[model samples]
Target: MSKNLADLNSLEERISALEKIAENFKKRAAEIDEKGEFVYENIADLKNCGYTVLTIPKVFGGKETSLYDYIRLQEVIAQGDGATALSIGWHMGVVRNMYENKWNPKVLAAVYEDLHAGALINAAATEPQTGSPTRGGKPQTKAEKIGDKWVINGHKSFTTMSVVLDYFVVSASIKDSEEIGNFLIRKEKKGIRIEETWDSIALKGTGSHDVYFENVEVEQEDYVETLGGAKRVNPWLLHIPACYLGIAGAAQKEAVLFAKNYAPNSITGTISELPSVRTKIGELELKMLQAKYFLYSVSKKWDETKEEERELLLPQLSAAKLVVTNTAIEVVDLAMRIVGARSLSAKSPLQRYYRDVRAGLHNPPMDDMTIGQLANFSLNKY
Candidate 1:
């Protein structure tokens, strides 16, 4: 077997190794959240593990793990720290998308090389004027063709991983054209800087700040894709819902531990022995199981699906994301109830989980949009 394929055969072993490394992230998660600082050390640890380039194809000297493998690893990382997991998810998803789509050959080669060297990338599409790109909002940022360069000027909001990104795949309206192109901008380039503007109550350590660009120049080859391209069902995006489910897993663990050990004077045994507590725990487990099965089953289907048949599964994919993310929020809430008032303490990780899971509701494939799409899909199918 090829070395890369052979390595993938040992995914469980590799995941075990990653789990050990995640311990340090779990240990430092509270501190990172409390300080509201970027998880630089976590990123460094992931890079050292060759995770930063996991999405680059094997030909480019990367692991080129499948979407399932990537989702599994992301869930493991999220179990330790949701902010770190979410921050890195952008990089992993972007790289995987580039590899799968094979954009401009020259640009892809450069990005692959950078990925090998531990570079991170995220699509800078959301702007102050337009909320989510999925909502079909045109970018306010504009890219103009100069003598031999494309000069870009615009601002992007919620630029996740801004503190650690080496490149940004930004969306900009083409000057004098109706087209909106995704431009690749380097971090060290002049006139591109991250503004300290993110002050969200959740995902506090994601470094998702406002990014500004004024006359940032790049070659024409840097523009990856024009907006309004044919849409495809993106299975890799399942990593997002997976991350929140991981956070819920952490909260569940904490709650179970508390229920097993905290025996009050009024009870004959620990709270876990109480019928009411057991019912809540059962409900939590059932919901989690359903969401996970939906996620992984759909992910596996995507892996085996023919390219032409993939678009037919868009409703299922969106439904999985919506179900898993919404279930994650409720799972965290139930976990907190299991832990009672102690879950509210700053020292408890449940509070962090509660806040972090809510961010998933705002992620792409938004709940309302997904519901509307599902309704349309059902009517059309009938």
Candidate 2:
């Protein structure tokens, strides 16, 4: 088979397996959200199915899933449970980026081994004071070279998958220097504690708790990479939009199901027959198509572009994120409109989808920044 056809076949097989796992996730998603508990079992299911290691480099004995394929997998998982998909998306995307960027060889080897053994990892960069790392916030998390080991001390906010992650790629300022470096810290390290502070109304099951590192130490080899100023366009970040799109997909499914069955005394048949409801559904489909096309097209471009040339695609990448994330929010809103007031019910999945989809607005490549980049690109090109 051709490479593209082989990849397609592989993706189909993987997605089919994920669909079965996602069905179980869908059953418990509401409860997991209601309790604001981490989707431990859902994550375990992913690990058991070897989905966690699919993005590891092929040299590392992984499937080496393409960026487009990974995003599709994330969307599928999100349709099952947005929280689980969002949480795991971080691990999957980070793994892909880390390998593609070629982090410290020894460190990468070790992490890959752990990944193959079902370990999960995510970057812990957001801090209470510094805010999102995307805004060039120097981490308050400090790492000091204490003899042969580095002692890391600080708190990280929004450490998603905190309850389940075996490794944390923490960004910290190097003590007594202007440099910031990312350190790979194992969860089993001493002086590390999780503060369950993720109380957001969105993606509650994400377990985005605060992690405190009071004198946590790691070997010198764990000091993976120094932070750099240039913002390289990372295609793996597309997983974020894929996740929200998946949540919107779930909302669409629920709205359609409700419309096809919900009959009002004012109507002769189900609400699906109503023109207004049909219009909303049509709008949902339009937005979904727009978002999916934008997301997948950009991802395909990223996969096809050479490493040096990929940097030039930053504007397009950010635009894709901007379009898809905003469209996802709108799609969920339309779905809720189709479902009416019952969509706001605490028991309804639409409510959860609404909250989860809104969280995408807070993800990296914020809409305003994306617009600014597009404007700059146009002005410079002209």
lDDT of 2 by residue, 1-382 (tens): 2222223357887787788889999999999888889999999888877778878888888778888898999999999999899899899888887876669888899889988888999999999898989888899999999999999999999999998889999999998999999999999999989999999999999999999999999999998888887756778888899999999999999999999999989979999998998999888898899999999999898889987788899999899888988888998998988888999999899998998899999999888889999999999998
- Candidate 1 error regions (>4 Å): 1-8
**lDDT values for all models:** 0.87, 0.89
Give lDDT tens digits, candidate 1, residues 1-382.
Answer: 2222225456787678778878999999999889889899999988877777777778777777777778888888999999999989888888888767668877888888888877888989999899999999999999999999999999999999898888999999999998988888999989997898988889888999999999999987888877677865677788899899889888888888899999999989899999999999998899889988988888888878898898888988899889999999999999999999999999999999999999999998998989998999999989
TM-score of 2: 0.96
The Cα error of candidate 2 at residue 377, in Å, is 1.0
List candidate 2 segments past 4 Å from native: 1-9
